[model samples]
Target: MSPPPPDRLARWLCHPHFFKVVLLLALVISAPTVAIGFYADDYVLLSYLAGRIPGSPPWYDLYNFFDGDALKLQANLVSGFPWWTDPGLKLHLVRPLASALFTLEHAVFGHAPLGYHLVSIALYVALVAAAGRLFLRVLPGATGALALFLFAVCDNHLHPVGWIACQHLLLAALPAVLGLLAYLRYREEGWRPGRYLGPLGLGVGLLGGEAALGGAAYWIAYQLAGPVPPGRAAGLRARAAAALPALGLLAYFAAYKAVGGGAANTGGYVDPLASPLRFAAAAAERLPVLLGDALVSMPADLTSALPSGPFVAVGLAAVAGLALLYRACLPAIPERERAALRWLVPGALLALVTSLGGFPGSRLLLLPSLGIAPLLAVVILRGLRRGPSPGRAAWPRRAGAGLLAAVHVAIAPLLFLAATASSADIARKLEGVARTAELGAPPRERAFIAAASDPMVTIYPQAILGLASPDALPCWSALSMARASHRLTRTGPSSFTLEPLGRTMLTGAFETLYRAPSAPIPRGYQVTQCGATIRVAEVEDGKPSRLEVDLGAPLEDPGLALLSWRDGRLRRMALPAIGEAVELPWSPGPIGLL
Candidate 1:
């Protein structure tokens, strides 16, 4: 007796060797990341591990890199905090498991970046495997394979995989999927060990990173909508057992708050414990944007490019459209697949809520992608089976499915490859900036950048230089991060007033990362650090318009080096004579990932 067409297709899709092909495709697509080298915060972490940065936490607690007092100290010592940074800013994260892994890797790999890249790639492969197992368990057969393919090819994973510091996302996601799978087994198959294993995985995920909070959403969703064992008492017991994981989440939160580990008084991150109302508002605004990005391929980073009003409106419209299409296609989908979506849709929504504590980006969509991938896969599969000619009445569903298939199947793979290349390009550009700074200026000179398009160019070069030579560590203080040309008027031998060619300062996306809008720097504010003094000389619309910098030496002093980003490289700028005015042109540079 032969099986039906659907069964035959399911067997073909689930063939043991087909999954290997998917894995291979993913590996090939992401292979470029292995050569990207250290980027952004990787330099900072490396310098701290090498004891080059004073007042840094011990190796085991390396991720606790920012706190109010610590930032003040670092600002004083090395000009670590940019001039625009808020004095009251507190952005601290505690990820012990990730720290421990870094410690071990540092011990073995030393400063070589290739070793770290290899480790990150290994973790990425493991995460992909875990996601495949998860899709199989929940959706099964052809649908599961399609989901795995969609997930494996997603470009969003590039950030976590390419950047060594972001491996915690992978670390958190692997156990999270496994934990959910274990919980499902315990409920559906009467497995005894899964009860404890489920919570254990959740606890480990918390240790991995705070992003693991997304895992708790799946547990909650399963408890609400997942299949229940036969009999009233048995079903009740299964549901009650699910609550055990919440204890782990509570313990994690309690410990995190006790250690004073959370974002505070910053617009970049909203701590639910400290400011519940603010967090709620942020989550609401971010949810639609995240959903639109995950479902219909809208870029979530558009929040940075577009004004809040228009961006949120577009995002809301996208979400509404996707919801309608999902509803239209629901009846045609198999009951088993429909059952999976019951929990997966809500689970993905809840998971997205967990990511709202920080800024919105596609990188934060990893856990949510778990639910999204299966949903998209099933819908695309249904559309393909129905063929293209389903009449005008079904045009909307056909169009929606076609759009999704085009985005995920064709465009996403290309984007994944481009993202890998972009990471490498960013690493190269940052290295160029570091090397240019190192060669152009005198050794041990106190360097102050007159103007740069991005803050990473100002801060990262110092860390990169420090890692190269700890004894002769480089010191750099940024005067402005506004993406505008500047008029440098030398008021005195040691003082100059820098007026931006544009209206205001610190308005760019990278600049605001250090100082959020909620805590704006007032005019007449002054700070002296690293042999230089900075004052906000004028204000425009509550943001600085001009900055006055006193270098503590004559304008032509050999010990002073004036640098600015130009033509894709950091170059030494000639100091202006006293009472002379010069225009410092600003050239846009690569906006590296954070």
Candidate 2:
């Protein structure tokens, strides 16, 4: 029943058990989709990319956010970014190939919620299946199976995998894992020119999710740590050929910089000005959070059940467990993969340290978990390898293995259900707001809509649909309005605001332009369907100027004034009549409700 060497991959990927596990995990983890719908970012990004909204993000719009001279009303326009739309910031493009996936998907799915959801699920299963084969090949018997099952049922993945907009992570990860698996296969057989395809896929996958870059890192580490096979000279030559694509990527980055791609702001973490101690401390503080998020649940998710004192203890203990497992299993591991253990350290570092930069969400942990899963599987398999021999010690080892397996089996499904439940909760709230946008979306200028409950869902509550295109009257989030009030004080409305936040205030759907902040102010600011800034309240000695200007209501436009009120709250003001103008006193900061 043993699979042939070449057929090894097929055995894991095509096995009946893989299918069964995928089905069960899908039912458990994605059961929430029954109630789940498009969420905050999904409505905006998907619609725009699919050109379902006015002022859609054209191809290469990500960089346009940085391009000062880029087209007007481009959703991502950055009029005056301090960094000048640095190329490092748009690192998202490394996975630009993923956009093609979305394009094809929407062509078939046509933005149907069911279609997007199913596609997302299918990609998730595909990623886990590919990862399962790689782990099975690398790790000892039965280890990759358990690790893959845990990966399928992994708690953190629910948010990233279940959410459609977040499917980029899945798309990026699949190719990365595939590339690494292909590298391993080539390492076993002789490397050929076709092996170069592995690196090419990796390069594309990197753009999908930067975490996929780990696949390239892994290949490098494998060559370094793995013992050279016979014909070492020729073997490395073949690998060198495969490595050319990655080298070309590096060359591309160098060329990218030559083209004015802004330098990465490593100053925050890696700068000489930054205190090394503080950097490590900050990274340290985040490490536990990343670990906790990956190993169990987020602090927010566990706050009530697990108190701060015990939470730290559990987090540390979890860390301690890994260290101990590595020490215990270091001896039994096959020598070739034994050196490969070093990969786990960086992998853990990557998973844990990434938290220092961004918000500590489970999404951040997905890539690191990909690394962590194999390491954990190796240790578990290593321990089982030593135990359950045919002797007095056999029962003890068998009992231990059974207990460990039972815990993984039981906890996996529970974590999956918990992930689905958490998703369901967020979905319920977003559904009401999405419905509002679809039904009550306004059709004219000088208008804003209050979100049902979520503060982050910006723009109108509705998206208008036509046979070929979609349109809605311009709108504002509270943040957008505050930004408008602040920018009008200096740059005036219609001119591109030089600052980044001010830049977002200008949605590209409508035409508007402004002079620089230092330039002369216009008579008044006006955007056709959106509202305009009429005047700025001058402030001297920090006292409020409270300037007054009239915002005329358009006959066809919704006569709502977007205002920022006390405690950073935002609300809309209604005009008495369509032709009436609201003359209001305003300060330099965000304006408030009348």
Candidate 3:
């Protein structure tokens, strides 16, 4: 059917208070995330700032940030840690206020995960509210509600809100933008913008290094959507006026640095330039997971419900609706009206780009996504105006809205399922079973069985680390641990050690050898004796053994034998594959997974 008239659509949208009320209602509805568990990254940031150790450091703590690897940049900030090698490395350079606030929260909340979750949830709610406020002001007659929903769950943010660690993006962005919005409102009233001095200053100060980033983002949005000045001289003056806020933003950023204690050491991560290429290449290969992440962080079982098909569908639909609005309504918007939107959309885009430096995910995109709501609302409003008649106007908009809302409903339960389906609970149960299963065996007998069943904890020069099966542990944790330890330490140009190996190495190496690889055995084993070479046969019973070897011998073998180590219980086995390593199934006693 053909679309109805425009005036009727405009009349429907021009309702006096629907926008504000609906916006408020949405905030009220989604505010409960605070009650949820602190998802992953929330734990990391909070723990770091509060200086709490979750457990022993994994072997690679020397280079990893979680191990205090980022301590090199700071002048005097000493990291509190288990990984003590790089104590003052400055890893996080930009967000001192975030770290400081985390410390403050810890002081008040003291490792209560709930408190962190609540703060994150509250900030999310506030951000939603502020977005609504901005929408009401900028799009007064637009479909602000659609924009609000889009901001909430359009991307892979479902789990990000729940994840306690990654909520900093939202937490920092909310107050900073709300403060600017308030300042903008004050300015619109022709009130002395100086009255905003308090809120603006506080927001910037609280945000610290992020203040500049946040302010720059807001200014970009303002420039895009605020009124363009009348011609040359006036435009210059307007530009200068805008520059004032920019200056204020920059001043606070500098102050953040001056406050000292930037992030300790930037952690030895894959370089950003390197990551984008890897990400791009991995994009095609891992589209399913990538898209899945853009929707929610559910457990594997929940993936079926919120599958990639539906996520891509909703995302595409949202894009279509946005396109319609931008195409149809943008031309009709007044120069001044369009200014604010122009300021925000591009600004938000810029923020998104910067935030995605080496990685792009729901958590990283939260603020930028939230900031663009006003622009999106403007689009939806215009789309609504293009409808046929008053009765028909909202029908198309409603259809689009209904689909969007349904997506949220379909997605919410999946999020809950994910939170509950933790592998940690599974692993704990497994350990209990193992204790009973091995009951009454002699210590040596038990050790051999343990080694046979355990995941390898360490990979020596000749040995490879391994992990229990994914069914026994969560794939995420298994993968996480495996990745944490499989690297050789990079010493000066000439020196290196095997400590750089991360969790992935243990898992992969273990899986390969434990599962069996197609290769021939290198038959002979040689060990050093006092000025002599000695040969030893592979032990067949999978029991602990110590075979003496000659030292100072120039035999071809370099202690090249497979060993299964558990609680110091060692079993010598034939090294099956030369290029690949094997993993015994037992967990390591003195191992960490940071």
Candidate 4:
């Protein structure tokens, strides 16, 4: 059967424009979930936001782009202290937007995961659509769609899209790419030179927020891809011949700085040239991982790909298609049909400069790689369009296009499934309420217990509607409080001074308090058992502070100090340690070891 000549739907599906739109639709579907609750770098920001921590809302909390006062809104509640939280120099505020939106969702959804996750998914979807549309507009063909799909589905992209905190990177890339597209169009038409200024200006402004480097990469690509007089020599001299784009870039840089653009400094966090050899190796190694991530669903027992048998068959077909294009089809390609290849050189260079871990990291490659996709797509589609007789070529072209399309589109459902499971796993780990009960008595019942339980979980206060709501601590706030006070803060028996055994003994006392039945021991160091209590008898400060317990754990070592209040009335213990439970009585502080 001849398939009764293609119907409107069939023709539309095969149309390059339709396929591009379909890709756009896929992008839209992915955006919402990509903007959900904070992840990765967000933890640093959230640490500063907790009311229990010493620091108040930080200055330039969100990329520091806006006025100082706006950033202070996220401070810790109890102490009106401000924290300059980010180690990275840039006041990148992308997280603030995500945090603010998540905060709003928190108000309405009451900590349910779905609402925030939906936002991230939606943002990713929009990003994918924007990228596809951008490519199709530049070069319309099966190849264009294929390139966009590959960029979208590639495994490296999963981290940026799936992780909520990375939305800034995505949001920034979208407008920047659009602006490049607009600028390219402006240049192509020899339109009013001043008109090129507008899109260029917008691209720079957006670049300041998500990623300055990404914006710079695209600008470089534009200059490389731009048309020059046919006889002009390449390199710096060619750019000098027509300096409009250079001027535009200069203006863009000035505007971006004026708008308060800067990225967080990662000076010590990641060595600028951390193991370039290793990174390159990792990138090469990740190719298979990326492919599997993009194409396979989680818990692989549920779904599988066509075996290697079919993959080899398809690979052969693709190779044959490429061979036919160069050998038998190149001569037929129209002269005007080809665009300049000058851009690829610079684009490749730009990609190299920005690439991290070779070719795999999405944050590093996504935007720069956009330039390469369309060019590859056009070449591939052109080959398919010309090979075989017109009648025979039609089926092969359509089949090839479909195969490419399937590979890209299938990525979304697979990624979606994997992300769903991953998010669920993370959510389960955060279900602290149930775990809190297992400890028996509330942590607050004793200072030692509270301190001991701090590692496992500690719920701290958050300011709610202008009221300091210390008791109603959420998991995020609690974890932030525990980490900031116990780890970051610099008040305590020096963690460095304690031997491994001493530290464990000290930690075990705190844990014991939380496990103990209801009782009031002492504010600082005292033990309550069998009705009466035994407090530390004396204190001496020499090389390290020391205390004498009345009737608790005996000295495991003379160096170990027994901290007590008043033997009865000390307000607090500066730094205390216990030798034995029966002789040297001691209690852990509310902030745990700190």
Question: Which 10 consecutive positions of candidate 2 have the poorest summed lDDT?
Answer: 509-518
| Predictions in order: lDDT | 0.78, 0.48, 0.41, 0.39
**lDDT tens digits, residue span 125-235, model 1:** 777888888888878689999899999888777788888988788778878778878877887787878887888888888888888888888888878776555653436
1-594 per-residue lDDT for model 3 (tens digits)? 654544554555566765565555544544555444433334344433433322322221211233223323121111111111133333333444555556666678875656766666566656666666666566545445545555654434544455554454665666666666766655565446634652574465345434236445655556444564344234656656655655654565466445442332222212233245633443432233332333333222222222345544544544556555465455556654466566666676666544433222344555565555556455444544544344754566545533333444345444434443432333233333333221122221111111222232221110111012112211001111222222222222211222212121212222332111222112243422122232322222321122222223222233222234334344343333323333334343322221
Candidate 3: where are CA atoms >4 Å away?
Answer: 1-35, 41-90, 93-97, 152-161, 194-212, 229-233, 248-325, 328-339, 384-594
For this target, which candidate reaches the highest TM-score against the unseen true structure? 1
Q: lDDT for model 4, please.
A: 0.39
Candidate 1 stretches greater than 4 Å from native: 1-12, 70-77, 232-241, 302-314, 387-389, 438-443, 592-594
Clashes of each: 0, 15, 70, 51
What tens-digit string does per-residue lDDT give for candidate 2 at 71-157?
Answer: 433333211111112123321133344556666666787756677777777777778778767666765445556567666777677
Model 1 / residue 183 / CA error / Å:
1.7
What's the distance in Å from true for residue 497, model 4?
Answer: 10
Residue by residue across 62-109, what tens digits does model 4's lDDT show?
333222232332332112111112212233333344445444554566
Please tell me which model should have the higher TM-score, number 1 or number 4.
1
RMSD of 1: 2.9
Ranking by lDDT: 1, 2, 3, 4
Clash-forming residue pairs, model 1 = none
